[model samples]
Target: MRFLVDECTGPAVARWLEEKGHDVFSVYDDAPGIADSKIIRRSHEEGRILITNDKDFGGKVYRERSPHCGIVLLRLGNERGQNKISVLRRLLEEYAGRLPDQFVVAAAEQVRFASKEE
Candidate 1:
């Protein structure tokens, strides 16, 4: 799976994602200082899911139907790389394989999946 990690996410997370063979790009390196909407659009255009701690994306992508290959809205209290990696690992282990068709949110206490009916 391809991913576009937000600047809030640390470098180790990016490296581990790449080590897993996913084409992962950090917003800091690729879309540095870009707006959320633009990042969402870019991720969609690149066929990559977005990993972000910000909740605004959930509203933008799910409520407004913003373009995104997929959405993984992370909610890690501590922004440390290790915590992020652990949360990411659990999320991927649980749903990355069986991910649904639309935007998804991986929160600290819950994992929410939303998709439009075909």
Candidate 2:
């Protein structure tokens, strides 16, 4: 799946996805310190799902609705990027189409999927 990996997601997640043959773009890679609003817009325009860990995006989406491909907010209990990467990969494999719309937000304990109703 195409994705816009957030800055917080780290390079490890991005690399893993790339190895999986998914077209992934990272905020820290091409651009650094970009505003979330701009990232949201660009991701939507590019038809890429956003892979973020920022809880604030919920508010952002609430206040400003953009055509976001989708947003996966990660919250792995372990802050360690390695642990988070494992969870993320599992989600990506399990959730294919269902996620493109309502993506998974990884919390400390479990992963929650929140997508819009069709």
Which parts of model 2 are misplaced by more than 4 Å? none
Pairs that clash in candidate 1: none
Quickly count the clashes in candidate 2.
3
Candidate 1 per-residue C-alpha lDDT over 1-118 given as tens digits, one digit per residue, 9 for 90 to 100: 8888887665688888999999998986766778888888888888888888878987786578786677777776777888888888888988886453466766677887777331
Q: Which ten residues in a row have the lowest lDDT in candidate 2?
A: 109-118
Model 1 misplaced stretches (Cα beyond 4 Å): 116-118
lDDT of each: 0.78, 0.77
Residue 25 local lDDT, model 2 = 94
Name the lDDT value of residue 40 in candidate 1: 82
TM-score of each: 0.86, 0.88
In terms of TM-score, the best-performing candidate is 2
